[model samples]
Target: MNPAAPVHAIVLAGGRATRMGGVDKPAVVVGGRRMLDTALDAVNDCARIVVVGPRRSDLDSTVLQTQETPPGAGPVAGVAAGLAVLDAEPGDRVILLASDLPFAEPTMVEALAAAVQDADTVFAVDESGRLQFLLSAWRIGALTDRVRSLGSTVNQPMKALVPETFDTVLFRGVTDCDTPEDVERARGRAAASPVSIAEARRAILEVVPPLPPRSATLGTSLGATLAERLLAAEALPRIAVSAMDGYAVAGNGPWVLRDDIRYAGSSDELELADGEAARIATGAHLPSGATAVVRDEFAVVTNTSDGPQLSRSQDAPVRDDARRRGEDWHEGYRLAVEGTAVTPALVSAAASAEVTTAGVRGPVRAHVAVTGDEIRREGPLRRGQTRDALGPVLPQFLSWCGVRTVADTHLRDTSDSFDELFREVRQPDLIVIVGATGGGAADQLRAALDRAKARIVVGRVQCRPGGSQVTALLPDGRVVLGLPGNPYAAVATLLITVPSIVAALTGRTPAPRQLARIANASEVSGDATRILPAVPQPDGTWRVDPGIRTAHLAGIIDREALALVPAGAADGDLAELVPLPR
Candidate 1:
């Protein structure tokens, strides 16, 4: 690689530092200097450089500090985020270095960029010959192409992006600060704890709950939870009803069969004289003088001088097929629980119980905005622009979670764009914001919330693809959840948080997560619980899709459940599964 060839360096600085007891590894002082500064010195000659993490004053004013879509999303994610900030073309040279290498030297990077002249990528091997993927140099085009080929697994280990057949080179002597002995001496006392996924959810729900109960028309009660018990106004089977297509007999055994037929909900009831039978349909009200209903299959008809007569078949017993009054529900009997979901079957039950209206926990009216300046609402994207994926899917998703979406809009990345949305936020109990929650210079949602004096109910969670979500409660009795711009992250956070919010507002508890046996093992990322896309197998086990990434949605379109695998869960563990939007 020629020194004259444009080069960009990406310094991944977002380690959660769990091994070091939750310190900021990049900011840790080693040899009287921050480890990140040591790493940055190695690539000082690069045409441009980007550091992926929170804004740090220790960085050179010229160095770019941007955050991964959801901060603390691991090295691969930081690499991608750093790449996005570079604005480099395919043929440009890039050096990927981690911030934890306290002793990294500039000569190592010079050797890497020089070695990459013969290969598309050159990874530095450690003294022990172990590949240090984070300490590498690559042609920007080649690296991105390989990343695209890796599909949604791009966020996985760097090994995942290896081209099956390609040219590569190896340089040696790049050491990382991972030894327990080295960690013991250099660990700092920073208490920058990453919020756990559970903690974030609990905090957000603690501040947000369901709105008051409201009357809903029976026809429009779908998807709402009942705020009050559905009691029966009239006894089920108000009249003796036929349970099957049969004849209503007036006496025991042999009877006269008449042609007069009685169908369900008929205006009048006919009298069945002694030894006579009346034809009746299933669910039909029995005639006033009828005794028991003998099914059509159980009756044996015979021609007689009086009329067509019937008797119980010798093979079939003479039993009544009648539904007795109040067998299903008596007058004033509880038809449904207070928190019962108003499914189609339940609504039908309400209709049968003569319920014309219901007391239901009303949905929180929501306004959705998918924000980004580089986001193109329509037409093919050009250069850095991307298609908006979160807006179209959210309306349907919120409906499933019992939220009524009142409006939808797209916002550009601007200082006042967030302020405008907040100013117009009315009627809705929630204003859902996508993007603009992280450390990007263009991220204005956070500043806007601060300007409005909104109380942040939840901050960054420790979960991958969803850590950047922020929930805030406004003074105007409304709340909003700021989600990551990436479609996968937005979706992951949406599924986990929305249900809990709905349950809180409606005075009902969310349905417990379904526990399914995990069919495969997944590498635990961090201390937080991970939500992986999964398909529930016919055998009641969940097939986890570990291949999903924060930016891609390829295999996830067909996924039904997201397995909430615990931090140290093993294969065959019964993991809790949350439902995805259908």
Candidate 2:
């Protein structure tokens, strides 16, 4: 990070002080320091400074002073004039701050610059959702281009000057000194970097995205988190039933047989009267007024002159064998709580409870595509051509990761195809593109990202088999994860990035990883973390399965896990076993 390249601040101090009763607001002192100097101090760490307005002796001498195209034109003109004299290179961050925000903290400026990671602009958003245009950070190149394109509209509102299609980062620390009350209120307010693979996972899980809660049918709710408690639609076992095949008898044993059997689907035909018993199958309703049940194996039915009689054996015990209504769950019973993952078992219970629908978090749709000119389907292997491994495999992996795929496509290595995918998928949670992620001759993911202006959050993973993994965030908050074209590398990176993506959408805290001790020692290289495929042993240890290659994923076929061996780690060391897909 070139501190020189990160931020170049432009202080818009040219606004006519009509709001301040014609006073030179930037020169006005606050907290025993000049407001202009206070603003300068806020961005003191920046490489260059351009204070747009009339120069003041009280202001810091280090800042360059410039006037709007027509002096005193609005803040937009001030921005244009600042850009005219702004000493910044392409990709440098441009911070636009007002000299009158006496309360603006220097740390806020740094934070804004840092947040310009996956966004074109990172500006202050007041609690009321108002855009604090002046107190914002922007890409120097994007801002410059937008300003130059404004032409005659350079003096229009700041909103008009900003690019229409750009991502914004909201900062809560941008209260202005437009009024004395605003100044007083701002003074009362107070304010308070990259990650490892585990650190990345933790950071992602910390994010609770804004996927709305939706009512989904039980069939479609699997793997989604329940957004509300699941109430029993009716109840499990809505009617009382026999828990086992037995004779429903009333009073003591030696009861007369009713001469009829009750099956599971049929209601009891005869309620047992005193000294009478009826045979009932499992799950069949116990006859009303029945007292006890004698197991068929433990009871005797004998033919007598006055109808058959049922009696318990000498040592046979009589017990109630009926399942009462709502025994498993009563009507309106809370079967599953909010935030619970809708598992198959949970769905089974829901079905038993007669629930047709559940309130669940909306499915996070991942639109997947594989990029590579050499990747072909429905063909035998040819020179420089590989099979379409990702199209068949990634969707299944995505399902296990709790992401639903709406489309799976295979495309050539071109920016047009990549950009078209972005244009096509409307508001997807994730866009997973396989292949062309590294800096190889045929790699086109990097160029596509540049063309789309995608902000790279996890630029690359420092892990073996997939060190070129890229996770970028689009302007719309959608994430784009580029996995290496190599099948092994793609699968390796997918195991790491996909779960993090899922956690980000669901806000699920990842369980702490337990290290797997490897028995046989293996030598490794590289400063990046190594993702070694391993087979878990019966004793909770990992047997390193070491033959992984870029062109093939055969090593991962029978492997149970991908172990994280950090840099400088030796043999016999316990490495973290990455959570497997699903």
Candidate 3:
């Protein structure tokens, strides 16, 4: 790799922010420059700047429209278009970033580029240890084939490409701005700063702390505190019943005759005298004196003047169906241990072993709040209104992890209203508010949260389309998350942020979402993680494309998964897509 090779920076600026009244988000201003410029300035050290979007004019850099091959579908096509323009040098590195991020810093970009020196790809890790796929570095040669595979829609997440041939770069510079209000807040911060870009960079870096390592354990009961070893089972006496009709006999004991026995039902008890025999059905307890009970089917009943005689039938030998006392369970056996998931089979086995109520960890609780005035209700929409779309979607997303909404409230997009709502719903272990955390006139979520004496855990993340995300902790010890109202941004914040908090609270390890790769190749600029909505194909692959219009519910209706285009994706670049959990 050449230490001085010219590096190209690609900024993705083509998101449609419908919540801000269907405005072009990149054109929104923060401080003195547009959000696009803020992102470009942060990565100025790169050799060239390429803007990837629908309109070339939206970006100040050399604009590249999505590729003509896949036509105008969505970000995956746009990325393929961008990567098609890059020079195919072996060591050339491309840094991809999202334009909506107002707080991204140049230092973070440099760090990501440096991390992917020998690997095919590298991405940023946020303060909470979540991977920022949009802000990353890519090795051009490694992703060339994958980029060509994307179709009109992207079904997989961008991170899926990493497992194919990539690595990761963790930094704090990839913040995204998804809603109109987020754009305004970035502008406000810029206006308040002597050097707005520097201030934003500082804000992003302040939240950078490595996440705690995840542990691998077995024998831990499902939901129980994890441990390396298995738990020991208690001593108990148990028996197994014959599943079929057959004779019971001790391996070394004499078999009793059929006629000398008194018939007993399946559950009947009997007392036997020495040298006496009894006929027992399946599940019937063996008499005290009888070593084994032979089946009547195999024993011959001979009628004579004396009492009927009994003996083994000449047809065949009776197979043993008898269970010895304490055969199923020994004095002691370890049936289950710690760190093991409590499966149905395990539960049943424990019951048979006389064990009940295995220790389990408790579930984590989450509270979500959606704030905004323009949000529509689910019922019929009047002349100029619609239903509150986000209200329904956000809860569905959280339900994937089995986390229920313990408390929720909707407030008007006003400071006082927001403050009041926060006061009411902050009782949950964790709280999430959707919309108005940005900078617009109606963006009162951040201010209202401030008034509630909430400590900003992570005020802003460095990523595209979802940068306005704010995480705070109330004085009463409840965690809160503020998500932008743009449907896509809100979904992204929940996907990236909420899951971690839920995992921490519930003591259950978060499982990885299923992953696939975009069939087409695309390129993007800058150093921010980019998330795109996509649909899955019959072949188990995903296609990257645009989402449904904000007003057209049909556009999002068939959305199969979320695709991630890393910061490293170049024009004609291949990225990973993670499917939403079913």
Candidate 4:
């Protein structure tokens, strides 16, 4: 490749595949070639390729795999390592590809590269409009600066880097292969077309289920559908009591003219005779047989021996404030509608309409297991050791979807201890392990999960930053999620996977909301869904504010929302924003 046009592609392939019987995953055969080979083939035509992983000797491509900076640092570190390698060639951009992506398309790479002419980074978008981060392209300089400032730590999720600081481009095509099942699925789909519209549609339908029937009183998230929790109350008749300081009367018959009157108080014993009148306060009841009410200001008061008598002023007309029966309530009145998101106004309306408790399904609970020898509470850090940063934020992220952490415990990443921990936290709606998911002596999360007597459904997702994520459904109705130990990858996993599971469990679908604006240029290569962190601007647009990738707790505290940069976006793409539920 020409030196000036040295746009190198970095393929991340260092994840340990404990679910694949603890074998080398990138070397696994897919489409008659090693997974790495397939990924290189997809990108070789785009630019010079660099492989990022622990062992590059096994890879067939001519690309160089630099030992990960801050060994076992995480996906952000892996990206940083790749960027560091490409740093030698100033002005040269780096296109990132995950080795497990068997369904990557060259068109996406071209699109992303084309988009970078105007933006800082270009990311790929899947057919469903989600951004694919791993399969992305970035300018070497900015990415390197972000990595250096953020630090390449396992706890710092790479998505947290996305904020208003980076400009992004969205493209289509960066499907990744995270697990055996994902590889199989991609193979099955690849046999058809790289970007098969039909396959994309089918995948979307399979991933997102139809909404369940809702009640009229259910509130809605900003961009989510409203529940019909208050609809049942529509059958009841409603009366609109004056919401202001005004009088109520019937607008029938000529206004009665009277001078002497009795003030109706709480004493129900006081009754009005036919053609009689009374003086009433703002909320006082009108006298019987009185058809209209004349304001005290419009009335001429004459003091008499008995009491003050009232008569309408010469130029003032008698005003009528009537409360017609059933005026507010009528047949065919819609108390609420389907797909309408709940808001304060909706809640107030439901309350005014006398809606009682609303029926709502609770969110699905997910169990998280953090395993490591170095894990410690956040406090004074020992030299060469740090605290478990992801511990605090992970729970908060889950809580937003109403999914509570059933159990959280730290264990040594040993097969035996992991087995015990898994057994203890098992039976939750979902089980997530933070560390030891990758291949290493201490990385035993996937191994322990598989060894359990529970039926394990292990597979990887096709995307960047979190491609190594492993998910399984245990035989005992528990979902196990194994995340990379790196802080950045862990956070990304939570952002991408936890939300979906929570939405599934709580019946709250993940919907996009306008949270913030992108401040800098950030783009992805081919089509791949990418999620990033951002700070919300005063005007409601999210500014891409990068966060440290090593500390999960720190990142969460600093960032307000997750900005989703879609695949195939260019410099000025309007990425979808999902506010971190607090």
Clashes of each: 7, 1, 91, 85
Residue-by-residue lDDT tens digits, candidate 3, 1-582: 565555676777664455677677776655435677778887888876667665554444444444323432345444555677665465787887877777778887888777777666777777677777677777666555556554333434465455455566555434566775565565445533433222333332232221222342223333233222223354333444432344444333243334333333444555555544445566655655555556657656556565544556776565555676566556456664543444456656666665555444333356776776666666666776646777766666776644566665666766587666666664456667777878998888667666886556556665666678776656775666778777767776677666555554444444554556555425333476566667766766566663334332344456766666666555444454545655
Best by TM-score: 1
The residue-level lDDT of candidate 1 at 308 comes to 91
* Residue-level lDDT tens digits of model 4 in 144-253: 76667775446466675554544455544546666677776665554333222212222322233333443433443322344443454553234222222323233432
On residues 271-293, what C-alpha lDDT tens digit does candidate 2 reach at each position? 66788888889877777778766
Q: What's the best-to-worst order under TM-score?
A: 1, 2, 4, 3
Those runs of model 1 whose alpha carbons end farther than 4 Å from true positions after fitting are: 1-193, 522-525, 536-540
lDDT of each: 0.78, 0.74, 0.58, 0.58
Reference-based lDDT, residue 243, model 3: 28
- Where model 3 places Cα greater than 4 Å from the true spot, the runs are 1-237, 243-247, 252-267, 270-361, 378-384, 462-464, 521-527, 534-541, 546-556, 570-578
Q: What is the lDDT of candidate 1?
A: 0.78
* Model 3 Cα shift for residue 512 (angstroms): 4.2
Better of 1 and 4 by TM-score: 1
Q: Please, what are the lDDT tens digits per residue for candidate 1 over residues 243-289?
A: 99989989786888889999998987488888888889999988988
Best to worst by lDDT, what's the order? 1, 2, 3, 4
- Prediction 2 global C-alpha lDDT: 0.74
